[model samples]
Target: MSQKPAWLTTDGAPWGRGRARLVYDNPWIRVTEHDAVAPTGAAAVYGLVEFKNLALAILPVFDDGTIMLVGQARFPAQDYSWELPEGGGPLGVDPLESARRELREETGLEAAQWLPILEAQLSNSVTDERAIGYLATGLTEVEADPDETELLALARVPFREALDAAMAGHMKDMLTVAMLLRGYHMAREGSLPGALARAMLS
Candidate 1:
């Protein structure tokens, strides 16, 4: 008789997966379909999408409490999107480097200070897409090198007005919306510099 591995513990068991098959794959994502045995002893099948990169977002705030937003037409949905500077970094690469590159590429702004603001899973049920957001300050202008596929328009808006627009549904990109709200929270909670926060709220 064969013995189960000691490292495989069922102490707080939920579900067990059976055989898995690769359903689809691409450079960016892969889909796997597998059989699963639920904790209730019910059988189920799961289709999982795995992302090959980490999503990185940067919210660049100028000293005057204005944010740099990028407007472009997003595909599939075929709608115009106003979003924070965002891009993908290889999974194992340092995300900050990706953030710096993306911010520069999109807005031609570089920051001396970068604060980690948010870490989250974008779609837990469907895809293993992870995201990280940063608040960037001490900005200086540089030359922008936008992606070939992007036709970007830059907008500098007051923090409060941008947040209000997002809250009113004018901005629907989840990362942008979340970061704007978080910036507001930081201002109210005194997590940011008093003058800067006041400027943002004002």
Candidate 2:
């Protein structure tokens, strides 16, 4: 099958990219500053941060209408955060593989069913960080193997309560909030099994 052209994937006229050079480099990211001609024909300078990996977020729902959560202290925010299982996948690797590993490593839960739900450019203006969200169901317990650098707290909460917490500002992680809202939407829109949706909302 033929793939769509790259230019067809973006909206509006594309900026004419000029000379670009690496400003900084790290294992996880690279910063590049470039000269560009904007769509408006004005000269501009763009500083783009390119990620070496794709971000993965997983929302694992059990048969009992509950979801798993992980709490940890984030360095950049310097605050505690409760979020769904999240990790980074090598840019060339399958994100679902990373999601599965993250879920298992953090919560010791594995799911038989995985559904790709959403994709977002986390900060398109300044970064090329892309994230993928997945919905995992039919969960089972396993032994957790957390990353050496991570310290996490785990919880199992009813779907409604989790969503409420996310909406009520108790959970501020962007990926977590987006996943909760998306689940709520899927439940209401009949995308999920009726019984499961009812139980989740209950």
TM-scores for all predictions: 0.91, 0.92
Q: In candidate 2, residue 94 scores what lDDT?
A: 77
Measured by TM-score, the strongest candidate is 2
State the displacement of the C-alpha of residue 155, model 1, in Å, after optimal TM-score superposition.
0.2
**What digit string (tens of lDDT, one per residue) describes model 2 on residues 2-99?**
49999988898788989999999999999999999999999999999999999999989887789999999999999999999999999888788888
Q: Given candidate 2, what's the lDDT at residue 109?
A: 91
lDDT of 1 by residue, 87-125 (tens): 999988999999999999999999999999888889787
C-alpha displacement of 93 in model 1, angstroms?
0.6
Highest lDDT: which candidate?
A: 1
Off by over 4 Å in 2: 1-10
Weakest 10 consecutive residues of candidate 2 by summed lDDT: 1-10
**Cα-based lDDT at residue 147, candidate 1:** 95
For model 1, state the Cα shift of residue 174 in Å.
0.8
